[model samples]
Target: MNITTPTELSWIILLQSLIPSYKKRAERDTSVPDAANKARKFAQRYGEILESLKIDPTCQGGPLDIILLCKLREQVLREVGFKDIFKKVKEEENEKAISLFDNVVRLNDTIEDEGKRLESLVRGMFAGNVFDLGSAQLAEVFSREGMSFSATCQNLVPRPWVIDDLDTFQLKWTNKSWKKVIIFVDNSGADIILGILPFARELLRRGSQVVLAANDLPSINDVTYSELIEIISKLKDEEGCIMGVSTSNLSVANSGNDLPVIDLKRVSQEVAYLANDADLVILEGMGRGIETNLYAQFKCDSLNIGMVKHVEVAQFLGSRMYDCVFKYVEV
Candidate 1:
């Protein structure tokens, strides 16, 4: 499947709009030693590189596209010795989300209508996705006052989302069970535990073999493959079950990605192997789903779900910030 920035998007404009926020985030990352000084240097070096790419398109020795730009930003971060800057926040949020996981699952279980339950699950995913710290505005608000999952769910921008395809997806969900489902997960804390795990659990209970593809390394606040494994281990019972559902059919794969945005062609061999037979593919996060691969097509069914966090993205979609996208395609 081919994935590129939307035709209407100007690469330079998008890059310019995004760079300042990213620079601020890097500067605020206290995890790196002498972070302020390092971040300034990082910003200067990254900006210089971008200028070179603009002056000479072939200067980077590769396509100077959105994916390439994101990768370049991350490469600079690592070079500046900033690794997993959100580690502490991720751990703290994970603990809080895990503590509330059972209740969230039980709430879903109590919903009698299948369609409504699925809607709730989708809403939960959107709500959990709001914990992202990559967006400059969100990071500021999150740092000042914590977010409540339930409150966020209730407050999501009213329906008829920018790319609402949830109704069609619900029809398929009710009529058939996919043999295998691959979910490209995003973020840590509520995003993975509260949002995605319950949805994946439902799939497992429905007899689908589920593969969760996570980052091989950290990017912003996205969870890593190893961290996901540990989270699952902690949530499972002595019987090796998650809130009573067997985890025997659940698996995790490293996506061989270090950036929040993913390039499908560059995923790990293991992920490619697992996805070979997956009848359903779900990309869940603003970076992986909305900003990058919103228009990507797959051999089987695919769902790209996320909330628009950045103004540039929201404007591109002609939607308000925090508006959700549930673009579902069946091939």
Candidate 2:
């Protein structure tokens, strides 16, 4: 989606604005005991990135959102010895999201109608999106304890969403069967355990191979490949294998590049190979779907599901904050 009025989401604004609230966010989210100092360093390196982008940082530069600012942030974070800053955050949320899985699955199991169950599952995915650590704004609202999945689902007002593609999505799904699916995951914890994985489990139940493509390195609480392995590991019953995960039905791949943004045309070898055979592609979370691929053309059927975290961006796209989008485009 396009946020045309110009945002600090771009390289120029990032340098000009110097990344707002960095001191607060860094202190809160990072393990660097001296986040204030790191924020200063991070800002300095961010300026260097802007210079490399050929931007004066005062006037104009290349297109907004074209250059991945998350990439710049990752480099800065690593240089300051805060590579796994969100590690504890991911683990906590993953455990919390996992604890609710059985209850969510059980709720869907009681629904006799397949369509209704499927809709409920999709809702669960969106509800989990509220747990996003990507935006500190949302992280405060949705990740709190005692915030039940059903409660979150209940709060969702159906339709009139930022981009509602449910009718098209349902039409396609009802008529087709996918043998394999590639889910481009977003945040860890609820976003994965509650959101994407349940959908994958359902695909497995219906005879489909699923590959979870995660970041090779950390990007704002989004699960790393190794972290995803750990989360998947705990799902195993004392038996050495998770029920739906065995049979080679469910697997994970590293995106190879750790940036929060993805330009699939330049995807990693592992993701490229897995995506080559996948009949369906689902890109979840704000960065992958909203920020980068909101209008991305795919060679096959694709789904973009996420919530717009920034109100300015959301409004620029003719929506509002916390507005959910489920856009389905068939190639």
Candidate 3:
């Protein structure tokens, strides 16, 4: 159950590029009283830890990598009492995305060709992935001018993406049907409600049992298991349908992950159990899909879909910021 990392990835370079942005986010966190002051303290302590690791690598006391760095950052944030820094924004965006869910689905349904429909759904996934507050640039843009789901979908970068596998995946889509799919979801608001849910609905309609594994605790704006359950509850009718699709086949699991980046070997027992029979495994968003587990191999067919939201990631992939990754592998 150990996930693999790409040999090309340099933990030192990636950590150096990412830590500054993360510190900026922590400094801007307004979830606690005297927020700016407390955030500065958190950043100071976190930076000290990183610097110590640099001065004496062995001082890290564990692997000096993205997972360890992110865990350290979160540990510092919690020590400063900054819990769920983006909670309010997540709630607000979730409401907005919920209101637009039907319209989004109806539009997807209008596409008569199944291939085109699938492409559109995947595009929607990339677009919604932009609602991430974990990215310093996107967070600022979102705070200044809120995101538009449809606009984003329309504005995705032209095809032949950095890691394009859509055409191949479409062929598989037309030729096969997976019995069970486990999507490691990311972000709140449009990311989940408008993007992933619609795609998951498609799987449910195709008679696949789907399990959405969300973070057990808040990390950036990534949705939590409880929040995902509530979102599903609101989207489903009393008859247990979501826009005419039955949701009985859909369920949510806690990922036992608190960082935006995930280490598959450490997931909750619940998700591990659910994934046991899965025929397809999808890791969504930049954190899970790109930064941490882009090259991970699985026993079943796997897809890693997300938008490259960080400069470091884009550099590593040799793609521009906001470029999409739709890598698919059939085993």
Scanning candidate 1 in windows of ten residues, the lowest lDDT window is: 1-10
Query: What is candidate 1's lDDT per residue for 1-331, written digit by digit as tens?
Result: 2233443235645555556656666676776778888878877888887766666666666666667877887888789877766787888999999999999999999999989999999999999999888776777787899899999989999999989999999999999999999999999999999899999999999999999999998888899999999999999999999999999999999999988899998999999999999999999999899878988989999999999987778878899988999999999
Candidate 1, which segments miss by more than 4 Å at Cα?
A: 1-33, 54-57
| Residue-level lDDT tens digits of model 2 in 1-331 | 2233435444344333425434345655546677777777776766666655443332333344534456666777688756665677677778888887777767777888777777888888888877765565665654355366678788876677978888777676677778888999888877788878777877877778889998888877788888888888787666544543453578889888587678787778989988987888989988787878888887788889988876555766888777788998877
Candidate with the greatest TM-score versus the true structure: 3
* Tens digit of per-residue lDDT, candidate 3, span 21-89: 556655666656787777778767876776666555556555656788778778887898877877877
Q: After superposition, how far is residue 194 of candidate 1 from its true place, in Å?
A: 1.1
The positional error of residue 316 in candidate 1, measured at the CA in angstroms, is 2.1
User: Lowest summed-lDDT stretch of 10 residues in model 3?
Assistant: 1-10
The list of candidate 3 runs beyond 4 A from truth reads 1-31
Cα-based lDDT at residue 23, candidate 3: 60
- Candidate 2 pairs with clashing backbones: none
Candidate 3 Cα deviation (angstroms), residue 318: 1.4
Error in Å for residue 204 of model 2: 0.8
Q: What is the C-alpha lDDT of each candidate?
A: 0.87, 0.73, 0.87
